[model samples]
Target: MRVIAVWSIKGGVGKTTAAVNLAALAAREGARALLWDLDPQGGASFLLRVSPRRKASPRRLARRSVELRRMVRATDVPNLDLLPSDLTYRTLELELNARKSPSRRLAVKLTPLDGHYDWVVLDCAPSVTLVSEAVLHAADDLLVPVIPSALSLRTLEQTRRFIAQTRSKAVRVLPFLSMVDRRRRLHREGCERFAGGAEGFLRTIVPMSSIVERAAEARLPLFAVAPSSRATRAFASLWQEVREQSASPTD
Candidate 1:
């Protein structure tokens, strides 16, 4: 199974939205997809229309008799499931830090659920703290959403450095522009510059649209609600790229 983590050190960059849409697309493509809501904010859970429930901390999970495999809940969409998040996840870092192998705890906890899912998409919190580190350790690939601007690119640099510093075994780090608007001069210039220089990156860019916010308001995936929309086509192209990457042999 491929585990893709939708993450960004910078918030409000559409990470949760991408995770929700991508997982839904994956499910529609015949994969058993699990959207694991690692963000304490539970925005992914909210988008999936799965009510958040308080889950035990890593310590409590480690001590519990029931395996995490039992906690999975089906979404309204077929072949897509959600592992709900709660406010208690806010303290996950502290609990993880207390462990011997904190970075790998989440990976270990998720092993049993692996068999049940073809793809596990983690909606990570917008920080590089312990919790984010733990989630990164569990992820097979990291998908970063960046706004087409200098600040977002700077954070992208930090993310690249962090991944290098840790030498994470995560096989892939894919970064793409989110909420891209071609109408703006800066956005257009950014795309042109990046297109000329951004080697080894997927070319599909998510354009800015009210459809995304509408999907959020409707608590449904964009493709499910508006299959003919530009946003839907963008996600479909993105999903195609993701599938190609996941199918490639890893180092």
Candidate 2:
């Protein structure tokens, strides 16, 4: 599986939303996609209409593949499934510490289903916990969605430094602007600045449209509900870029 971790050091920046939409888009293209809800709050579970209560401990999840598989449930969407989360995951770090390499714990859990999914999207919490660190170490790519604001930049910087320090499996950091409102001078300026920053980074910014809020309200992917909206188009474009870049050689 091509694991993609959607993360941000700051909360409320649409990281989970991006993870859901991107996974759905992959599923729409006939790719088998699994959304792994890593956030303790379980927003991804709520979005897909799945309950996030887990009865198993992290040690149990690490030891039994069948048990872990039993926890995974197919969503209402075809070719899209979910690995639900519970607050029990808060102690995941302590449990993983018993292993030889704690940072690769999630990666090991994913090995059994190597060919089951074309894409594995992780919806990480907005914190630098052991779980989040493990996800960064395991993922093939780290998609960081930043709101177009000055305050969000600090979080973005922290995310970059952490990724670099880990020397993560992530070959590239795909940073994108989200919740953008062109009407706001700050938003426009932030988008322009980010777009001009790098080639590996994308220029397609997810506009702050009510369509996004509506999608969340309906608990559906943005494309499924509002395919014609600007946000939908932006998401589609971002998916395309991901596909194209994934095909390229990594240094």
Worst 10 residues of 2 by lDDT: 61-70
* Candidate 1 wrongly placed segments (more than 4 Å): 53-59, 62-66
For all predicted structures, in order, the TM-scores are 0.94, 0.93
lDDT of 1 at 39: 83
Please, what is the whole-model Cα lDDT of each candidate in the order they appear? 0.83, 0.83
Local distance difference test, candidate 2: 0.83
Q: Name the lDDT of candidate 1.
A: 0.83
**Candidate 1 collision pairs:** none
lDDT of 1 by residue, 1-251 (tens): 78999888999998999999999999998899998888889899888888644453445654324477656788998999898787767877887777778787878888887678899999999999877777778888889988889899899899888888766675588888789999998889778876722845567888999999888899999987788999989899888888888888766
**Residue-by-residue lDDT tens digits, candidate 2, 86-159:** 67767667877777788887888887777888999999998988787789877888888888787888788898
Q: Candidate 1: TM-score?
A: 0.94
